[model samples]
Target: MSITLVLVVVMAVLYAAGVYQMLERSLTRILIGFLLVGNATNILILLMAGRSGLAPFVTDDGRSYEQIAEEMADPLPQALILTAIVITFGVSAFLLAMIYRRWRLANADQVENDETDASVREDAAGISAQTTADDRALDVLLESSDEGTAAKHGESAMTDDRKEDR
Candidate 1:
């Protein structure tokens, strides 16, 4: 097959893979899809530069050639791809960091939308401020008393009772 056709096929496959990956739930997979898409774009650009019989750079024969003279791969596309790669790396790193932070906070990978209406209703009804300082203090006191009673009975007391009943 011609180089152009081969490149076009490669680009199409990469694009399809990228789209499929983007549809996945995992953020990591989405990032991989983005990278694939970026690569496909670079490949398209390189293909469009047109095929020449020789490289664009100077030769020892001293023909004094200008850039983009013949069949050699274009250096500009390569440079642009490198820059795009760096940018994509930075963006992917930032996205991963954001996902990590969200996971750490919520203990889940999926994004959760907030129920603002419920929150607003609670706020309007003064439910948000219903738990007073005294109630909180009492909860703490009760919890401490429960723990003290447990400690007094010994940690294995409950387990021992179950064994005796059995």
Candidate 2:
């Protein structure tokens, strides 16, 4: 039932490093952070799970149900660890693919600042909503067009369609 000091410290270090790495701009760093955090979480769950004992499925011939239950190791923490491992693997794989693609396409691992984020910052800085509905609609239309959303249904997305439509 007692948790070792060393394990607790390791978990703490993992969490700290994971969080710090997660904040980095590099996709590889983020993946490492995610893995660290997942491992730390697994460690935490294991520590909190208490002493390991006999499997819950086994039943002694003469032992009472209460005694069997007391000796049974909790399955919840083990399941959680398994689930976390799976989620980490899937997400890391996706991140790896994205990193590879970025590297292949641009020869860079650094993520560029998205223009949408910049525009959102500008809106938050000061955009008056006190204007008329017509102005707001026009603004939405213009912004969507600028982003190539083609808010207008008649606008064809492909070159061939464009010739026919226009």
Computed on alpha carbons, the lDDT of every model, listed in order, comes to 0.77, 0.84
Model 1 alpha-carbon drift over 4 Å, by segment: 52-55, 66-73, 113-166
Residue-wise C-alpha lDDT for candidate 1, range 1-166, written one tens digit per residue: 8878998999999999999999887777887898899889888877776554554566666554554355466677667778877887898888889878877887877645469977888786676466676689898898678768888978543356656886
- TM-score for each prediction? 0.55, 0.66
In angstroms, the error of model 2 at 65 is 2.1
**Model 1: pairs clashing at backbone N, Cα or C within 3 Å:** 52-70, 52-71, 53-71, 54-72
**Highest TM-score, which number?**
2
lDDT of model 2, residue 152: 57
Model 2 residue 43 distance off true place after TM-score fit, in angstroms: 1.2
At residue 110, candidate 1 shows an lDDT of 63
Candidate 2 lDDT, 1-166, residue by residue in tens: 3357889999999999999999999888988999999899989988998899888786658988988988899998899989988998998899899889999999987778999999998886565553566698998787557547543566544467645885
Quality of model 1 by C-alpha lDDT: 0.77
Q: What are the runs in model 2 whose C-alpha is more than 4 Å off?
A: 1-3, 119-166
